[model samples]
Target: MATFTTAFPRGFAIEVLDVYSGPPRIAFKFRHWGYMEGPFKGHPPHGQRVELFGVCIFHVDEDMKVDKSEYFYERGNFLAGFLSCPVMRGN
Candidate 1:
């Protein structure tokens, strides 16, 4: 129940690994999922460049805005949402 935002940096895109059924014991837990199979199906895993790790919680408003009324970074694991963040390197 805390204000949250996409972890992706400006203009940065994340190569999605997979977005499966939620309620993970790690940290971020969503009651439902958006992305699915078929057009989303693949060999081993399935998902697109997940730059923005969209999460569902009572932190921010439905639009993902700050709301002091209901803001809670459960377990203090904000970074966990970005665990699959794209790895980048430049010259």
Candidate 2:
């Protein structure tokens, strides 16, 4: 979590696309975005916006609290965002 903050210090945004409710499972699709204005790992800030699209499903207890969560997304696409900037290309 802290690593993400260092990578997108301005702010990270989430947009919920869809949701399904169930006693045993709740699921949703989402879009997440933020500007890379802070250093990530050893990479310098690139001042570019990065976005992630994915879905999450949660299993809940009888008390309506989440007991487990599963997340699905394209790992390559997410990592590519970090490398797409000019700084990474020696430009």
Instruction: Using lDDT, give the best candidate's number.
Output: 2
Worst 10 residues of 1 by lDDT: 36-45
List lDDT for all candidates, in order: 0.29, 0.86
TM-score of 2: 0.83
lDDT of 2 by residue, 1-91 (tens): 8987988887899898999776689999988889999888778888888889999999999998999999999987777788866667777
Task: Candidate 1: give its CA RMSD in angstroms.
Answer: 13.6
Displacement of the residue 48 alpha carbon in candidate 2, Å: 1.6
TM-score per prediction, in order, is 0.20, 0.83
lDDT of 1 at 33: 23
Least accurate stretch of 10 residues (summed lDDT) in model 2?
82-91
Task: Return the lDDT, model 2, position 65.
Answer: 93
Off by more than 4 A, model 1: 1-68, 88-91
Query: Residue-wise lDDT of candidate 1 within 40-74, one digit each (tens)?
Result: 11122123233233333233455555453222225
Native-referenced Cα lDDT, model 1: 0.29
Q: Give the TM-score of candidate 1.
A: 0.20
